[model samples]
Each structure stands twice: as structure tokens, then as C-alpha cells.
Target: MVTKVVLNGVAIQAEEFEEEVIRQNGVPLHKIRFAFKVRSNEYHDIATLLYEKTFDVSVPEKDLNFRGTIQNYSTSVTNLYKENEVADYRLELVETN
Candidate 1:
């Protein structure tokens, strides 16, 4: 299990992030989701992670550290501009090695 997400040099809070491994189109990838309440004004500079295209992920429980590229980016728009948006940030990372 992923215990922390460190992008650049910032440590994103665990409460706002979720991590898992899953197969998409028969390819294995690390899936990370960021679900922050609309109230928290903390922007972890998600754009940088997307633009940089790579990050170091820590799975503390497993004592693993690896770097991967952002293979996919997506968001969930509950109602577009008409309503509050939630669950709207996600990333799919494929290990280069």
C-alpha cells in the first residue's frame, strides 16, 4: 500500500490521497487519487506533477521506493459548472522499469 506521495519536494497529506495498483488494458499501473474537500485551499501543485511527468512514490508498509511516469490523467466532474465538484483528481502511473 502507498503510504505517501512526494511530488517535487512537497509531501501530500495522506488524508487527501489514495493509492492502489490495478491493471488497465492488460497493463499494470499504479493508480493514485486525490480527493480534497472543496474547503481546503491547499493546492499541492498537481499541475507540476502532470507537467513534470514523473514522481517518487513511497509505499512505507512495503518499504518500497520507485519512480514512475504519469501515464494517464483524469478527473470526475459531478455536474460540471452547475454544482460542487468532488472526486476530481486522479493519476495512473506506469513504472518505467
Candidate 2:
């Protein structure tokens, strides 16, 4: 379970997390992409903050902690009358130069 995405001193309560490494010619690269989400009521407050073109981002999880910048982001709302309480987000980031 994802806990939060911290950026620029603000923490966003996230519900999901995904991390991927980009490689070229079987060699490792310094760039990384991360996706995270926020469910329930806090979605509206923190949704916009995750999409900054360039900002310090920190993802502290049970297994690993990633810190980088906001390369990109997208959000999805369940919108179901019964399950209208969920917000999903996907984020991309690259290592700071």
C-alpha cells in the first residue's frame, strides 16, 4: 500500500504506487518513473500538486524510498455513485540533474 508522495514540503496521501527503470542497450539509466494515487476525500486537495513540471518529489514506501522530480502526472476518478470515493493517479519522474 502506498502511503504518501511528498513534494516541496507537502505530503499527498496516496493509495497506489508503481516504479519503473528505463534502460538503454541493457545498461542502467539514472531516469526513473513513478506512479501514485490518492483515494477518498483528500484527492481534491493534493491532486494538482503532483503534476508540477519540476519539483522535488519523495516517495517513502515500505520497501523503497524514491526522490526525484515531477516529469508528468495524470488522475482518474472512479465516479461510480457507490464508489465515488476513489481517485487514481499516475506520475512520472526523472533524476535531478
Candidate 3:
């Protein structure tokens, strides 16, 4: 038996800042770095939220068959903020009979 979990369309939130430092020639240098953190709905939380949906494998007739075959499934998060607007995730199940 196999189970898979995926997270999609995660957003990155951060800010840009600059710092001044003295160089070898006594000249001031400016350095910049983008500081940010990843923000998104937690995968576990999303999975739990999906409980209300029809994601149950046992409910599907094809899932009950353990014959040699591969099953492909997918889910996605459509609405994301900033750079994480759209993403898709796929899962594959292989049965060894």
C-alpha cells in the first residue's frame, strides 16, 4: 500500500534591505539581500480540509483492485498570493499483484 501527499502554489513573502560596509579602498559598498519566508496553507491542514471532499481511495472501485497496474491521480490549489498563483501535483500508485 502507498500513500502520497503534495503541496502546491506556496507563496514567498519578504522584504529587501541594503547595508553599507567599508571596502579595501576606503570606499563604502552597499550589499543587498532579499529576506523573506515561505507562506502557504499547511499540507497536513489541507489534507484534513480535503477530508470533506471525495478523496477516499476505498470509495473508488479501481483502487480496490490490486492487479498489476499503475494509478495516476492529481490535485491542485488554484488561488495563491504573489508568485504562487497556480500549481499542480500528481500521485502515482503501483500495484504488485
Candidate 4:
């Protein structure tokens, strides 16, 4: 399965991404959240954009079937911007069948 999520104009690879499972109907539902670090101070504006933007997730291939939703999201800005620090986030992917 190929899962792709884009946040703040930055596209993230969702492969091997961390997922939290919530069970329903004896089935495992997954909630996946990704944290990405910002490398440049110029990303501040883009970081702010995170508050207003909704991510686009693409699953080109899926052997196992599931449904997805945006459960929650938030963002953070540093006092003094630095590289390799988290700037913002998209959403928590809630997967259900």
C-alpha cells in the first residue's frame, strides 16, 4: 500500500509511519500521526499555513481496505527558529473499515 500525505505544501512519505490502533467490531482501526521537522526559517510562513490548510492523502494501492479521517491536528513555532525542529503538523489519520 502506498500512502502519501501532504501538509503545509510539504509532502510526507507515510510508509512505516507510526500508527495508533483503536479497536471496533473486533477489528483494528489505525490512527496515524506524523511529525515532520522544518529545516529552514523561511518555513515559518508555511508553518502558519498549516492552521488553514487541509492535507491531501493518496493511497494508490491497497491490499487491505480501510477508511480514513482527520481526527485532530495542531502546530508549533519556535522562539528562535532552528533547523531540524518541528514547525507544524497536519492531522491524525483515523482509519476504519
Judged by lDDT, which candidate is best?
Answer: 2
Off by over 4 Å in 2: 1-4, 13-30, 60-67, 78-84
Q: Write the per-residue lDDT of candidate 2 for residues 1-97, one digit (tens) a residue.
A: 6466666778765554556666657655344344555556555456556545665566655444444666666667644233446656666666554
Which residue window of length 10 is worst by lDDT in model 4?
Answer: 56-65
**Candidate 3 per-residue C-alpha lDDT over 1-97 given as tens digits, one digit per residue, 9 for 90 to 100:** 2222211222222234212232535644322222322224444444443343322222121223222222343455534444534334343333232
What are the per-residue Cα lDDT tens digits for candidate 4 across 1-97?
3365554345555434555678878888766776554446646665565545344344334322245656776546644266655455445666636
Please give the TM-score that candidate 1 achieves against the real structure: 0.52
**What's the lDDT for residue 82 in model 1?**
34
Tell me the tens digit of each residue's lDDT in model 1 across 1-97.
Answer: 2245565565544445556777767776666655332211333355444578877766465464667777776656433333433345566565655
Candidate 4 clash pair list: none
Stretches of model 3 off by over 4 angstroms after superposition: 1-39, 45-86
Candidate 1: residue 94 lDDT (0-100): 59
Number of clashing pairs per prediction, in order: 0, 0, 0, 0
Highest TM-score scorer:
1
lDDT of each: 0.55, 0.57, 0.32, 0.54
- Which 10 residues in a row give candidate 1 its minimum summed lDDT? 35-44
TM-score of each: 0.52, 0.51, 0.22, 0.43
